[model samples]
Target: MFILADDMGFGDFGVFNGGQSSTPQLDDLSGISRLYSQHTSASPVCAPARAALLTGRYPQRTGVIDTLEARGTDRLALDEFTIADAFSRAGAVTGLVGKWHCGAIGEPYHPLKRGFDEFIGFRGGWQDYWDWTLERNRTPVQADGRYLTDVLGDEAVGFIRRHKHERFFLHVSFNAPHFPYQAPEELIGQHRRTGRTERVAVIYAMIAVMDRAIGRIRQAISDAGLDDDTLIVVTSDNGPELGGDGEESADRWNVGLRGAKQHVFEGGIRLPLVLSQPGVVAAGEDDTFIHLTDWYPSLLTHAGVTPVGSKVLDGRDISGSFTGGTVDDVPRCWQWSRYHPMPTSNAAIRDGRWKLVHPAAAGTLGLTDRDEWIDHDIKRHPENYAQPIDEESPGWPAVGTEPMLFDLAADPEEAHDLAAVHPDVRARLATALHAWYEDVELDRARLVST
Candidate 1:
């Protein structure tokens, strides 16, 4: 059962219904995609998403609900077990081949310390595709400086060749179509000839380059006859860059999704999760609701391994949902954290058509509140993290404000707020959101109780 997820924007592929470019590989794979609706990343941002995706626990419980905005002593706790640890315990080889921004420099939270048998690519999120200044397992790899995308693909293929005989998991994280967005000359030339002033061509070129490199990896797997045994899951860390106008042209980036990356809007949290497992998942789409945390259980189940213990997992194992099982009605939730307090309570609860967003009040920073704090702290207090520190509370302070509600099943764009009209739904979802969060706190206490 191999899943290949791409951080495909809302319109990156043609099969997206409102898709713009032609993503033959993804569109074809979607034949059995299971249309998992309401799937979301843990944080609206990247660092927190990876922290949650790797630990199978909500970022809030793991002290990483926000980005890795540490000065020194504020590092990711070393006691946590990541997905790689689970795979290792289950008797499988685990490796990471991309971005790992979960800790500060030289911290124990490095990928090698996080249970990966092998590590390649940068420890941070973005790196120059042309010049490889990124670190691999905390060592300088001396990037070719010609093009970055090609090198990342090459590394994955090489890793596959070396570990083909083992039941190994390869996490190929690509820093493509990401910032410092630089593609090759041939690709750039091809797009430039397209005659569109809208940098859509450049963005498309970036995706194209990534797709081609990915095809190489896919070919390597097939060549080694590992397609049947390998489970390839490829996806992005978050939504697209929404600034494709005069500023940079990605603002129109998500094609038409409601929000862009960075904030808790749909565009930022809603990413493409493409799973292509031969013989296991029938080629088609399923409209089930799931999220990043769910992948830990779903993949482990498919691999026929039991977890360390029931422990406390925020994600669910819906193996049946992937194997053509019908989906039951369940709601999804989101928490947005950055620097300052999230405008309003800084949470969202989605149940059926009703979706609630705890809006940042008129006087509050709103979307920028939390992010502002982190940014300011990093800038002003960079030296404040020079010494050892005491343990702190587990989660962000709960925001006490009215939530802005919308009917996603009714208004996916979130153009209208129904909070004033549907007080009952708002209250119900609000209660559920808070209770769920409290449960996360309780789990942390039990698992790491002193």
Candidate 2:
């Protein structure tokens, strides 16, 4: 079982938030699960982050470098093999509930075609909470007055019950606290009474509802008599979205980490990861640096299933780390921008405690004209927009600036730059980071041409 939260910050968990938000179920789960202190999403944004999570490779290599689906940037290359493919091939029932942002345009990109036997969710970056249109194996189902989170939770419980006698993989992705913050009046009133602004109150209420739904899912698992046999993992796709302007503002505590959802800083990529199994994983904190990509190979290994193909995986099987084993420290890289990918903009590489970043240039993060209608038209009439596998690349202005270096061991906030103090380390990491950029872009280019 894998449970994912959308735009949930490090501090959103009550265990880390000092009681600002209500996440009692997650807080209790953390006590019995192995908490990773240095877990990070593979990307700072949703599409690419989920692409990396599903495939054991970087998002760039999978042809999902951005979030805009109308331009077809969010589609995962068909050649890539997902963890679900491995599990399904190994004879386990696989189901996905909630957000399926990896791809949203064509039937080829639907979750049903992507190794999932059952899928009940929206296939976009976001949806209206109160008025949602979900698909159960490509058949649309209109909303029925229940909150979206609760609906997804109920679907997850149903999947578990139906497959209780067989091996199954269930991914429950809750699009909570992401946007369009709508919650029950009771939850909103509780937070508002504590003096939170309308936006903050609504966002916290969304998270609170999600927390309760998660508790219900756990109870369902226990009732099915699969507690000892199941491995439950909870995490977020990326960090919180610190919203913009007036009532739209969603700024809140993020556990003193720097930056927000679209940034390359710790706060953008750093996320909470909890793994629980009765006797397999002991309850304790592990400071190992774990990336979202690791889950692909790790989960397959845990289930004793081999990968379906020989495609090279950028992630390693760290299942041993679940039981206090040491994992090798590997260099990880991240780069993201709107429309076409600009390798030098908002790129970072972390090798151990030292991280080198090329900050995003001013005026380089605006959405394209394609974004305006993509969200609305694509979901309703996807056949109208049969986007090419690789759309023509858009021109972007080059950004020129020296990279900044930070010793995260000392400055987790990333407030101070030590590039001048550590020129040699900066040069070495820069070479490696740029080399990674070239390699992944090369794969992306080949994917487009073929």
- Candidate with best TM-score: 2
lDDT tens digits, residue span 318-347, model 1: 778666887564666667544332424556
Candidate 2 per-residue C-alpha lDDT over 383-447 given as tens digits, one digit per residue, 9 for 90 to 100: 67776435455567876356999999999999999999999999999999999999999999999
User: In candidate 1, how many Å is residue 258 off?
Assistant: 1.1
Q: Which stretches of candidate 1 lie above 4 Å from their native place?
A: 1-7, 17-24, 31-35, 68-75, 192-199, 244-247, 253-255, 340-345, 360-401, 438-450
List RMSD in Å for every model shown.
Answer: 4.6, 1.6
**Cα RMSD of predicted structure 2:** 1.6
- Please report, in order, the local distance difference test score of every candidate based on alpha carbons: 0.65, 0.88
Model 1 TM-score, all chains together: 0.84
